[model samples]
Target: MASPILPGSGLGSGLDIGAIVTALVNADKSAKQTQIDAATKTNTLKISGVGSLKSALTAFQTAMNNLGNKTNPAFAGFTATSSKTDILTATSDSTAVAGNYSVVVNKLATGSKIASASFAGGAASAIPSGTLKISQNGTDYNVDIPANATLQTTRDAINKAQGANGISANIVTDSTGASRLVISSSKTGAGSDLSVSGIAGLEIDGTQLMGSSPAAGASGAVNGVAQNAELTIDGLAVTSKSNTVTGAVSGLTLNLVTVSPGTPPTPAIVGVEANTKGLQTSVQAFVDAYNTLKNTIDTLSKATPDEDGKLTVQAAFTGDALPRSMIADIRAQLTAPGAGGPLAVLSQLGVMTDRLTGNLTFDTAAFNKTMAQPGMTGQVQQLFTGTNDTNGLLARMSKAVDPYLKPMDSKSKGLLDQRLDSLIANTKTLTNQQLALDLRVANLTKTLTAKYNAMDLLVGQMKATANNITSFFASLNAQQSAK
Candidate 1:
């Protein structure tokens, strides 16, 4: 006998096999899927929290690093000012000493400028073009001019000649309506005087361009002269070809503005004073950065209080000990006594901490008073930037924080970075588990569907046999009654 053929779902027994299989699969998957979803959400929140903590810690570290550098402008304890800005303006770096100096501006530096003699054809006039020889500061340049070149064309050619010799040319119309070619030097000293030749009809007086007394001209004419800057500092005479004067005083740069000192002889009083305001500003910045880090730690590590006053571990990192330990270490370093100095502790320098929030605050008045004391600025600087001093606040704090922020070696990761990596790995594992469960559910669904379809086909065959038997019996009864 041949095997009976199985009908598809709902065809023979009116039973919905596909729906039954789907319901069973969903029932088996719902519980595991819920757990996976919860785990994934937790991992994602932890990654974000760790990232925020790392960012805050890094910012605080940067502020501490800036305070540790002695050469920074914030540590510069000097300010320089000029009494007569018209005569000169000056600036001083940290190297300057406090003192008053007598200054007199006798003459200002001048650059060389020379003009060609008037041309008969004016600016548009064509001239016999040849190689123009231009010299400045002992360097010479040869500029080739095409034939029938106008003053404008000759000027353009001179400028196009590329060389180290600083020389420039231009065509200018004098007050008398005559156009002349003017050549000047790029530098401002006596050695930068310019000279030009090679135009057949043009002549430039070399002596006049050198700033020496020029011979009388037949009519109105202007000549260029080169001269050096003359000045006196503290009764010492000084001469330079440029207006910017340096090296006369250690760490002082004088920018000469004019030769005439203002009325009443305003001699600039340049001196070094304690940069108390700058130091105070930097200290405040450090305090603010520390507060930011502290707040981040509190948010990440602290639990929320319920309505009934019970503590709940509702935060992402509430159960984690790393953030709490890191913050505790930082607080200990901040409160400890600093290295031996006049300002031995942060409180002495007007930096204090809040009892509740564990954040730092700055007292401007106290800092100003401490900085005003003699020799206290150097001591304050040493407290933060001291060399490997265990008691130094910033030094100790940096040492403690460095391990967490920086990696130990090429193969090792930072504390937070490592935590995030672990969370990511766990997330991948959860995903793989979910995929495995789904595959098992799919296979079970296939098997169950086939069995249900076979059962329905067998039931349909039994019903057909019963109907045929009943029909034969009815036919027999009807024939018997007729007899």
Candidate 2:
């Protein structure tokens, strides 16, 4: 900012030129300044209003997506149940057919466990110096034993070596203070059993047990063999390498936990059916979400006076049509029929809208009752999620709101973004105009100060001339009086 030029006071006329110049400059700049400030404030409020509306719409879109997700049970999926969950558990997806099957778990799949021969020196016993090979499923994992290595060191070496197929080793001491090296494998199956056979003092093949000495009878033996899980679904034999079984039924996964226990071996009844409760909850949540969005829009576009009518607060978007138009489009989608079906509308699914307030109300009891009807749950889910060819209700809502709520880009822009862009541009122009106004005010002040200084100088010169003439006349009169 350039400093203000101090105007000179008139010497002869005794006029305050600085005050006059200041008043004139203020009067000249005030109107333009008020106009710029008002425009800038209005534009800022409009930007803030559009930003808030866009955020609310984004939250609504997220809530809608949750209902349309296939894994969330709202999208016409299925739920599976086992009567004896302790013996078996089940899970199903949307493609699963509704049915009941008798599941008999004869045996659960198991991994391999082997205990090595007892060492006389316990952990301190010297292990044979050689390559120790642990084999499982045709993969031999070798552990090189250093010279003077003890049973403890051998176990450490086995653990440190990367066990290709999930191998672990530990030492178990017997009653006579003898340390037994026990090794295990996580691979499960009949043919995938584990065996150890590279060194003499540590040789095991399910039955071989290495004792204290080389010639002594070995005490090591296989504790458990890798075996496949045996189960029967509806008397149809099913064998699995792992307890967690899949593909035994269409779109169903069975987790075989334990064998069925009874005098005649009781079977667990596994059933698969549509998940209605989850879908109902999702639908209600969507209604609540819509209501929340509507409330925000109402607040932003509100045009009302206070109770006292003395002070009225101007809303952020009082005259803005963008918020209203965006809400209208979304409401139209919500009211539109969803494809050709008996359950094509939201009202049929118990989602109703208020006429006066534009808020949504969910009738959970009505929804549950409709879901209780035979095969109506799937139809309602389809109404929200839609099929391959037809657009669903949620899909339609996306189409309606995406144009306004999507992120701004080069090719296209959201409505809120466009409004904000124009507001920012206006603010930028106002800022430039304000600068120009200030420059003009400074120039005017400078010019007026110069003119006032020049006039004051001329008045001082004229007063000096008048004083000279008066002095000359007084001198002549004094001379005349002396004569």
Candidate 3:
């Protein structure tokens, strides 16, 4: 709230003009300064809330990352070559030797064509030969019939229609000179259904022609044209579709080069360990953020106050007690001893406490040493991962922050991420308000100084005038006495 000054409050003090103006200007300045101060305080609280939340999140992420590395055995003693891909070969011998080995196939070229297909069995009796319609994947194609259109011509038409569906079709003549039409699906799926329709003389796989009808054709004939490659990973049979097989896992790719029956193929491994490193880094980032937030809250809450009982007007915070309350709630959640929690209590984790500050002080040397223990990670994981206990520290922290972290949770904003967003927004608003108020105060101060200066000048003039009159009267009195 700003103070509003009226004209008559000892404003000019007899030399009314300058003095009154100065008083008015000073009052306005003070009011503006007050508003600016209030706005700044509000902003500070908003920033504090956001900063604290971010720090907590970072910490949680860091803890999770550390635990992940510690718990995942695959990451232990894992190393990668320069290319980050491992190409290991396995050769079979007449004498079978049993050892740990996984097959990897590196060369498989896959192309599916209508395998040994014929239209109405290439017989004139079945097709009757006018115009035939072939439909694939629910799209219709028209084929023109000439006076003497051969089965090859119809096959060629089907091949030409391949471009419509982004599928390639071609006619291949076998060694016996038997011509076959292959209608390949552009993509594989049950949805890639093919059918024959609107044909006066055409049959596909002994099915009569109808108008764009899927059911009119033989079952499994229209959609049955597909190829599959089978490979094994870690002795487990895995079947996959695409030629380039990087889609299998985060850091694995399987390229099928050959199909040799009864022989296990060589496998290629790529960049799996590198991916783990990325995850580790991500987790550490979270920890770093968490620590930052924790530090910020601790600093603000514990800062000593001004001796005046009232914070300085320029101080940027409000409710001297709110930060402490929030910190306590957060700390309680973090320090709660438990199994299946974010952390297994501060003390159990080797984090010491300072009695006077009531803060958890980390002994980096001791924590590092303890973490070196063989089962340290396992112990940490047990606390955080299982649902065996509902008192998990992560869960508890989540619960505590939930109120402030959701979007649309509160009319102001919810917690999960919304609280931070709201805080930032509030901070901006506070900054603008404070800046405006500061500018107004500056203007008011200048106006007041000018007015006061003018008033002082006028006062000096009045005193000089009074002195001159007194001297003139004294001179006249002396002259009269002489006469």
Candidate 4:
């Protein structure tokens, strides 16, 4: 027997049946694989589905990053309203006015009788609270006691004080909505607080003092009149109960306590986490498909085999032709090295699959770092491009399979056209051959039939002759017996 070709090697072996069988098997397998690969490329299984998914994820991620780094003042919430004058102004300190203004009414009058009073020392409490009146110029004023007032009743009674006094007290609510009576001088300057005289039942800590200064143990009552408390604002004397002065400057709020407003407006919070979440979902899908393809490759490329020496693959996947090529395409893209390439190599991105376990683990921090680097995005595109597209993974694969696919170059000899020409020119060749075969079959059938018919006729004639002979012999035997 002639030498047989080895299956995998595709070379003839000196009729070694085993070698020949192996060669045939391997050759058939290789050819089948090539055909499968060609089909896969034409179908665009790996490129269209997985590649598009990854590209979309990458695009979204880039968008998110760009949004994150954007800085625009309009994005920060800032709205301000002012009354006529600019909220902020810059004037030389030396050229400002020195004079101060004040407001005072003459005919100060009060109610016939004082009801009650309170003087909150340093704390705000509802004890020792009452009502009183103050008569300034010709206007009569009744002071309402706040819920949280103390022995400051003498100060409260000053509401009933009648004279050329230049101070007035009123109750106002704070930002927290707490009511507190405030006492302020009609005059803003050195002597803005009260100077009690005509009013009785008034004293600052029990000692008599007339000016804008607070007196220790000022207390007293004269004809049901109360004393006054003193306070200062910006070196100008102004007084109030539970003072919570705000809006010291336009567009700015200031709590009377000990604090200054912080500078600039705090940036408004915006939600971009939704976009990141979407990107993550897309990326995860890419990861899953990639892993599936990787698993297919691992199964086909496994060194270990079963007792039948066949690779272990899912039952349906066994002998499936698509997986190996898919893996090769992926592996080629991931491992291919180029200067400043999207990843340089898969190892840089922690995308290398474990040889032993067939598992793909990632170093997220490393991957992120790489992505953040300059030119990383372009490199990433290159890695996914493979060899298929001018820029894709399948480009290389297509080139390799070029020999198996359509002809690389058309024949210049016009063989195809010539073949058609020959068929047209010799149309009778096929007819003649077909006619000859038909006539030969017909003649063979006729000859066989005629011979069989002639034999049947001969056998009939012989049988008739033998029957006659037998009848004659029987007659003769009977005559002899009679004689």
Candidate 5:
């Protein structure tokens, strides 16, 4: 919105011809320019508003999802603590219940690590042409030994072969310049240890020691025999071939680190308890996230009036149905009953909504009292994470925001994408129209300047002619007067 008289090139008639042309062009362009400007402002506001809504909704869904994870479920998780972490450690998932146990780790399971006597000829010791047969847990893998195969090559062959899944081999050379082929099995269980044979110089007894390479009986034990994990939970015996024990105590996993045997037996006290504080924190975070989304919607779609009921201030989406409709759709989901449990609805778990603001508020004290009841911890968790059907409050809320979560550049347009695309196209069209109008104005200015300059030239020629005629008349009159 500018003044009608604008600055332009004015060289021809001193009647301010430039100003006149500018005024004419302004008069032609003003109304359309104003319309375009207003439309652009409104569309830009809508784009910004929708983009903000999308971001807020996406973040809310993320916070909600973090609480709904199955493994580390929000307030219902049972934390497992081991008193003697040096002897043993414990971990529990959502399936674990609160309980105390006296665990005694008898001995740690040891894996078989066997070594060959020695290769006095170092890593270059040659072997006989026979298959190096390696067996573990009734499964056998064979490595073809070519004639004149060196000790290092056989170890490399065993390490690289496909069928040798858990068999490891290496040449360990002592300071005496003697290399011994040390091989170990990844298997830790009692009857699952690796057994190797079928080659002459590389035949090493997995249980004992013997002579060296080219001696026919070169074998020895590096870390001795394999054993199973022996431990007791609550005085009940539990034997595992591996040190890491699972399924022995329902949902608990016990990792036997070392021996804690004898006198009072050095027992490990493991305790599983409900994480009530974690549950409370998660609920508060969920409520806060939802409230943030609600606030954004309220601010963007706000249409407030003065005391006289006259709207003096306007917002981005004021009087627009889009924001209102979106909030209504999202709000309607909270009323639907959650997928089955003792805690049937969100309000039962203290997630309540305000009557006026439509924002959620969590009643921590009330929730804590309800959770304090016997066997209500897991029941309360089921409210947000539905059983059999994933139609819980969080699930429904996530679904509501899914439409707006898509990136703007995505081809599969989101809720706000179509409107944004339309606005952008409209803005471009308006720009083109403005450019066309400017071109026309420039052309008109040039035409008007040329016409005014032509008229000025004609006026100047007439004045010159009149002056010449006047001079001639004066000369004639003077000559006559003199006669």
Candidate 6:
């Protein structure tokens, strides 16, 4: 619909043809292009809004899931403490019962450490080559030593032999600058004692490896002695190869620090008790998470008030029913009575809703009073973690919100995810249409330019013919006047 493009109009019809053509083309495409731009902006806003809503919903679901988790200690509510922390300390899990334990550590477990006789050659001392047979707790390991191997090489070979050989070797330089191969048991216990043999020139003085000796096994020298940990728990004797003791107490692991070596057995008292403060903190976390979710939903679904006392609406989902309906469903689920339980409703557990704002508010004093009641903790747990037949408030709410916030899939795409996908598809379609429109506009511009250029050429030809006729008439007039 655009007019044809023209050259400098003053040389022909004295009209601005280029400006006229641009105006006509713009008028033809303005409405359709505006619609396309507006649609793209709207779809983009909708996608962003839906993404935010999904995030908020997922956070709320996580809070609900945590509260409903039966394995969480906060729900069962227990903590452990040690009276004599210097001697021992312990931690308790949910299964730990409230009780007092008397623990007496007689001796701490020790690992065996033995050293070979001092070599005057220091670390470079060449000992007998071949394999040294080492045994720990009846398990034998062969450490291969190369010909003329030094003390350091022998140590590295012994260490390289893996598995329950139960020994690690290292070289130690004494005060006289004499290096000795010191081998120690990898584990602590009386069963981890080490014995060595098969050094062709070396003498085994009991557990000590010497370059020369009075006689083999004649010197009964004890370089290191392995011992077990002895302890008493609740008047019962318990022994362990390591200081870390388990199975002595249910759901309690005692880390023995030092031995109590006196008579009359002054036992350390370890106590396990219910942790009410931890439970309160967890409940507060749930409340905070719920409030944050509520605020996000409200902001995304409602109009805002302007400084001029007018309500200016710009929410992408302002007219969307899904967000509002989801919020309503959540609120309804929160206030409903749980199935056949003492903590039938959230109000009974001290969680109340603000009527005006529809936000949840937790009352600490009331919650404490409820928890203090006999067997109320169990009832409270039941309210949040009911069976499938009798779904708890949190469980029900999570189920309701899940369908809307879950990811897109062939079998089951969530409501918000589906909406976003549709918007994207529409936007893509609009983009294709816009591209086609651009091609049409380009073709129209070319046609109009050619048309206008032909008109300008015709006008110039007419002007040239008129000029020639006028010149011819002037020449004739001049000749006649001269005659």
The digit string of per-residue lDDT tens for model 4 on 118-149 reads: 23332243443454444433444554555544
Per-residue CA lDDT of model 2 for 271-352, tens digit only, reads 9888887777777777888888989998988877889887766678887787788888988987676755678677777788
lDDT at position 100, candidate 1? 74
Best-to-worst TM-score order: 5, 2, 6, 1, 3, 4
Give the better candidate number (3 or 4) by lDDT: 3
Q: lDDT per residue, candidate 6, 1-483, as tens digits?
A: 333444546356556767666667778778988998888887888888888998899888988787766444445445667888889888764346678999999988887666666677889888788779876777777888789788887888888884345678787775678766667776887767666778853333334323233222232224447788999998899999988887788857788999865687588999977666776777777778778988998888787778786768567788789888888878777767665566788777678889998788888899898888765655555566554434766688788787797755668788887888898899899889889778777777777766776776788788899989999999999999999
Model 2 TM-score on a 0 to 1 scale = 0.61
Q: Which stretches of candidate 6 lie over 4 Å from their true place?
A: 1-10, 66-72, 77-274, 305-313, 336-340, 386-395, 407-410, 462-483
Candidate 6 lDDT score at position 391: 72
Mark the regions of model 5 whose C-alpha exceeds 4 Å error after superposition.
Answer: 1-12, 69-73, 87-97, 108-228, 240-246, 250-264, 303-339, 385-403, 406-438, 455-483
Best by lDDT: 2
lDDT of 3 by residue, 329-359 (tens): 6667665666543335555555565687554
For each candidate, the alpha-carbon lDDT, in order, equals 0.72, 0.79, 0.48, 0.37, 0.75, 0.74
TM for candidate 4 is 0.26
Backbone clash tally (model 1): 1
Give the winner by TM-score: 1 or 4.
Answer: 1
Comparing 1 and 2 by lDDT, which wins? 2
lDDT of 1: 0.72
Q: How many residue pairs clash in each candidate?
A: 1, 5, 35, 66, 2, 0
User: Least accurate stretch of 10 residues (summed lDDT) in model 4?
Assistant: 86-95
lDDT of 5 at 255: 83
The numbered model that scores best in TM-score is 5
Q: Please report how far candidate 2 places residue 425 from its true position, in Å.
A: 3.5
- Give me the runs in candidate 3 sitting further than 4 Å from their true place: 1-17, 20-101, 105-264, 267-289, 304-405, 409-412, 415-483
